[model samples]
Target: GTYRAFVDQLPRLDALGVTAIELLPVHQTDPQEGSYWGYMPLCFGAVHAQYAAGDDPAAELAALVAAAHELDIEVWLDVVVNHTTEVDAAGPTYHLRGLDDAMYRRRGDGSYIETTGCGNDVDADHPAAQDLVVWSLDRLADLGVDGFRFDLAAVLSRSPSMMSRLEAWARTRDVRTIAEAWDAAGGYQVGRTWPGTGWMQWNDRFRNDVRSFLRADDGSAALMEQRVQGSPDLFDAPGDSINYLSCHDGFTLYDVFAYDAKHNGANGHGNRDGADDNRSWNCGWEGDDGAPDTVLALRRRQLRNAWCLLAMSHGVPMVAAGDEHGRTQGGNNNAYNQDNATSWIDYARRDEFADLEHFVTGLLALRARHAVLTQPEWWGDALTFLDRRGVDGSTAGPSIGWSVGDLCVLANAWWHPTEFALPPGSWTMAVDTNQADLLDPPTPVDASAYVVGPRSAVILTR
Candidate 1:
C-alpha cells in the first residue's frame, strides 16, 4: 500500500526533474520496536511486509522500481548495515542476533558495541558479518534498486578490505554506493578516507560550509571556494562527494532560513533529542508565518541563494524531499520518529512555492547545458575575491566569487548590494537567481563591473 503511495508520486517527481529516489530503509523491522524511520533492520534479506503492495513484499518493491524505471528515474535505497533492531540484553534474538554472538562485537565485559549510537552495532571486521553485508547488498540489487546509500557507512569500513571488496562486487553489478563516511562513534573520516574505495560520501563539510556562508557567517568565502570546487581537499575523485545543504537529518531547506534553531517540541523528547548545533538562520521571525513581508521574501531569496550554489557545485547533489519548494517541518529538525505529516512530503507546499520550484528546474537545466560546472577540476590559478568598486575589501563580508574559463559565478550573501569586479570582457548573465528563466535571461552586463543583488547569486558568461 505504501509502495502504491510512492508510485503515485512518480508523475510529479519526474516532472520536477528529479534523477533518483533514495528511499529510507524498507528492510524488515523488529516487530516489537516502534522505530518510525525504518533504520532498525531485523532481517537484511526480507522487505518490510508493512509496505507490501500485494501479498509479496519483494514483488511490491520491484513493482515500485519498475514503475520508476518507466519514467527513467533511478532508485536508491538507504541500507543500514551498521546495526540491528536488537539493542542489548533487553532486545530479542532476531535473525542475526540469534545466529551468533560473534557477529556482534562485545566489550571484555560482554556489552555490545554502540558505535552506530543505535544501541547495538554489528562488527563488520568479522568474516561472517562481512559476507552478510555483501549478500544483503546483492539481495537488494536483485530486488531492483539502482544504488545503495549506506547508513553510517564508515562503520562498514571497520574492516576496510571487507568494505572495499563489497564495493568492488557492487560496481561489477553496476550499482552505485554512497557512504555517510562518518559514524556516531569516532569514525569522522570525511575527505581523508574513502579514496579508491569505489564509493562517494555525503559531504557534511560541503553542507556546513554552504550553510555558514549563506547565513552570512565570517570567513565563508574561503570555505565556499573549497566546496564549490567539489571539495577537492576531501574527495580527489570525480562525483565522489554528494554535495548537499539539506538532507533527512536536519532542517528542510526552507527552514534553514525560516528557523534559527530546531523547534522539535513536537518530538516529545523535551526537544532534547535533536542536535543543538544546527548551523541555521531565521530570516527574521522563527518559522514561516507572521514574519515581516520583507523578511519572508528574504527567506525565499536565501533558499534561491542556497540552490544556486548547490546547482553550480561539482559532484552529485542531494535535496531533501519537499525542498524544491518551501517545506518546513514546523521547525522540527530531528523527525526520525515522525511518521505523520511532519515527515511526509507535502505536495501542497510544492504548489505554494511554485516560483522556487521553477527556479530549481531552471537551475538544473542551466547545469545540464554547461559541462564545466559538472566537471569542476581543481587547479591553482588566479581566483578572485570580489567586492564593489570603491568599497574596502573585507575578508569577513558575505561576498565570494569563483571562475572557470569565461564563466564566473558571483554571489553576495551580504544583506546589501555589492559590485562584482568582472574580468575584462563583455559578459552575459547566465543565471540571475531573481529571474524566472535563463533563456531570455537577465540583460548582459556591458561593463567590467556588475552589481550583485543583496542575498542573491548571479552567473555571468563571457
Candidate 2:
C-alpha cells in the first residue's frame, strides 16, 4: 500500500487505541531483487519508492508520520543495518560492497560470514560501516520517525562499540528502540544481554508458550503463567518485552487456528522455507476450505481467546496488521514471494469478521484503560495464579487464572467449561469471549465463582 493509503487507515487504528505503529523495513530494496518484504535494504536513507503514491517517497513518508503524530501515534520504523541487498560474493554489488569488501564480515579465507542467514553480514566493527549506519539513523530521525525496530539486532551485539553508538544515537533522538534479539547464526541475546538500556525486545517465548498452552500442549500451563505476567524470568520487567503472538514473519492470528502446517509452496521453496514448529492447532480441521461451520465457530472463539490473552498480558501487546479482522495468508506463512492477494490485506474481511474486529477494538481499549496491563514492573505481591478450581498456587492445568490488583484474567483452554473462583469482592465481568459482542456492557457477577466457556477467557475487575 502507498503512504497515503496507510495514512487513511490511521483513523481506524487510532480508534482501535494503538499507541504506536511499527512499519516493516521501509528502506528502499533493490528493484531487481523483487523482495516483497523490504528486509534486504538497498539503502537505509531512501524510502521504498513503490510505497509512495507520489514521486517523492520521502515526502509521502514524512506526511504519513505527521498524520500519525496528529493522532498522537508514534511511528516505529523497522530497520535492517545487519545486512544489505548485496548478499554474497555472487550477489549484486550495491553501495557498500562496491566501495569496500571489508564493509562485510569475512573469514580468514575471505568468505563472507552468514550470521544473519542473508548470505553476508555487515561488519559493524568497520569504521566506515559504523558511520553509514549512524548517518542513516540521523536521516531517518530527521524524517520524523519516532522509533526503530532493529531486524536481527543481535548482529550488532558482536560489536559493542557499534551498539554503543546506536544507543547513543537513540538517546540523542529521545526515541524508542526494539530488537529482534537474535540472528540466524544462533546469537540469541534476549534479555539484559540485548545491551541497549530502555530498549525492548520481541519475546518469541511468549508467542510459543501461549500458542502451546492454548492448543493444550503438555506442560504448557506454567509457561503460559510466566508469559502472561510479562516473562519476568527472561526480562527485568514487563516493559522490556514486546509481547506478540504473530508478526509479519509467521502465521497471522487467523492462521494460528486455521492451519497446522506451513503451506509455503507458494513461496516457491518446496514448502520448506518457513518454520515448521509453528505451534498452531487447527481446531480439529485443516484448511478453512470446506470446513464445517462448527469448526469455523470454534476457530473464531480461539482467535478471541488469543486476543484476550494478549490484551490482559502485562506488557506491550503487538497486533499484526489485519489480524483483528481475521486476515489469513491461505496457510502460506511465507508469502513473501506471492505479493498478490495472499499477502495483500482484503478489507472486506473486516465486515466478515466484524465481531472479531469489535472484540479486538474493545479488548485493546480495555488494555489502554487499565494501567496494570501496561505497567513496567512485575506484579510482585499483587499477582496471584489460580488453578481451574480457582485454588491458589496451582496453574499446571489446561485452565489458568491470574489477577493483578483489581484486574483478573481467567483462561479456559479445555474443551469443557471451567469453574473459576473469583477473588473476594464485588466483581464486574468486562469481557467474555463466548459472547458475540465480546465487549458488551459489563455485567455484575454476584457469585463467588464464574464458569468460563470452553476455550474462552473471562476478564473481571473488582
Candidate 3:
C-alpha cells in the first residue's frame, strides 16, 4: 500500500525533470529485527509483503514499475546484498542463516566476518551468493524495473571477478547498474574502485569536496576545481562518478546549512548514530526553527550554490529525493529509523522554498540544454578557472582561459567579494545563485571582467 502510494506520485517525480527514482530496499524483512528501512533483507526472491496493496507482492510491485515506465520514469532499487536481518549468531535463523550459515561470511572459528557493520555479511565471494544476487536481479528485471543501486557494494568488490560477472549479467539484460561502492568498515571506493564494468558508483568524493569547498575550508579552491572537472583521478570514465552533495544517509541539502552538528538523539543511539564530521555550516544557529532572516537567506543561497555546482559538474549528477525543494530532516542525519514526518518530504516546504524549486528547475533545464554540462567526459583544458580579486582586480589571480563553447563557472568562497576576468565575448549569464531565481534571464555581461559576490556562484555561457 505504501509503494502504491508512490505510484500515485510518478507524475510529480517526472515534473521535477529527474530521470530515475531510487527506491530503498523492498525485499522482505524478518519481524524480529524491526528493520524499518528494509536494508535488513530476509529474502532476495520476494518483495516485502507489508508494502503490497494486494495479496500478491510481486504483482503489486510489477504494477508500480509499469506505472513508472508509462511516465518514462526509470525505477531503480537500492538493494542490499551485503548483509541480512538475521544479524549475528545470536540474532535469528529465519532465512539465510537457517538455510546455511556457510552461505554468509564467517571466520575459521565460525564467528561472523562483519564487513557490513551489520553483524552478518553475505559471502559474496562464493558462487551461491553470486547466484542468489543474480537471480534477484533477473527477477526484478523481468518485473520491469530499470536499474539497481547496490547497498554496501564494496562487498561485491571483495570478489571483483564475481562482481564483474554479476554486472555483466545486468548489462546483457539491459539493466543499468550502480553501487554504493563501500562498506561501513573499510571500503571507500568513491571512484573506479571495483572493475565497475557496466556500472557507476555513488560519488562520495563529489559530496564531501563540494560541502567543504562551499564552507571555505582550507585549500578548497583546488578541491573544488577537481570536483568540477569530474574527479578524473578516481574515475577513469565520466558517468562512473555519481556527482552528489547530499543523500539519504546524511543531512538533506537544506539541513546541511540549517544544522552545524547532527541532532540524531531521536535515533536512540546517544546522538552517535550518524556521521560526526558533517562539514556543515548552520549560518548562525544550530537548528532551523529560529534563525535570523539574513541567516536564512544565506542558507537558501548556499543551497542553490550546492545545487548549481552539482548541475555544472561533468559526472551524472544525483540529487537526494527532496533536496531540490529545501527538505529538512529536522537535524536527524541518521533518520534510517525515522518513519514519520521527519523522513517524509514536507510538501509545504516545497512551496515555502518555491524560489529554490524554481532555481533548481532552471538549473536542471540549463544542464539539459547544454552539451558541455552533459558531456560524457571532462572538457579538459577547454574549461579553465580564473582566480579573482576585488572589483578593481587588485588581488592575486590564477591563470584564466577558456574554449569557445565551454561553461566557465566562478565561485567566491572568500569572506569578501572577489573579482573575475571573463573573456570579452557574446557571453550570457546562464546561472547566478545570488539572483532571486537562479535564471531570470540571459543577462549579457559584455565586460572583460566582473566582481562575484561573497559565498556565491556564477555560471557564464560563451
Give the winner by lDDT.
2
| Candidate 2 segments whose C-alpha is farther than 4 A from its true place | 390-396
Q: What number of clashing residue pairs does each candidate have, in the order they appear?
A: 1, 0, 2
- Model 3, range 24-58, lDDT digits (tens) per residue? 88888775565467888888868888888778888
Task: Estimate, for each residue in 216-313, the C-alpha lDDT of model 2 and write its tens digit.
Answer: 78788878878988888889889989999999989998999999998888777789898899999999899998999999999998998999998899
lDDT of 1 by residue, 1-462 (tens): 388678998987887778899998988887568657888898887888998767788888999999999999999999998898887767877677778877888899998878887888788788888888888888889978999898997777777677778768887889888888888877887876664367778899998999998988888878888888788787876478889988888988888898888888888889988877778999878876678988887788888889889987778888988898888888898897787999887888877899888878877877777777666465346444454532444432677877766668888888777777787777888787766545464567898777777788998776
lDDT of 3 at 157: 80
The candidate with the higher TM-score, 1 or 3, is 3
Clashing pairs in 3: 1-51, 389-419
Higher-lDDT candidate of 2 and 3? 2
> TM-score rank, highest first?
2, 3, 1
Candidate 1 global Cα RMSD: 2.2
Error of 2 at 313 (Å): 0.5
| Residue 12 of model 1, lDDT score | 76
Candidate lDDT scores, in order, read 0.81, 0.87, 0.80
Between prediction 1 and prediction 3, the one with superior lDDT is 1
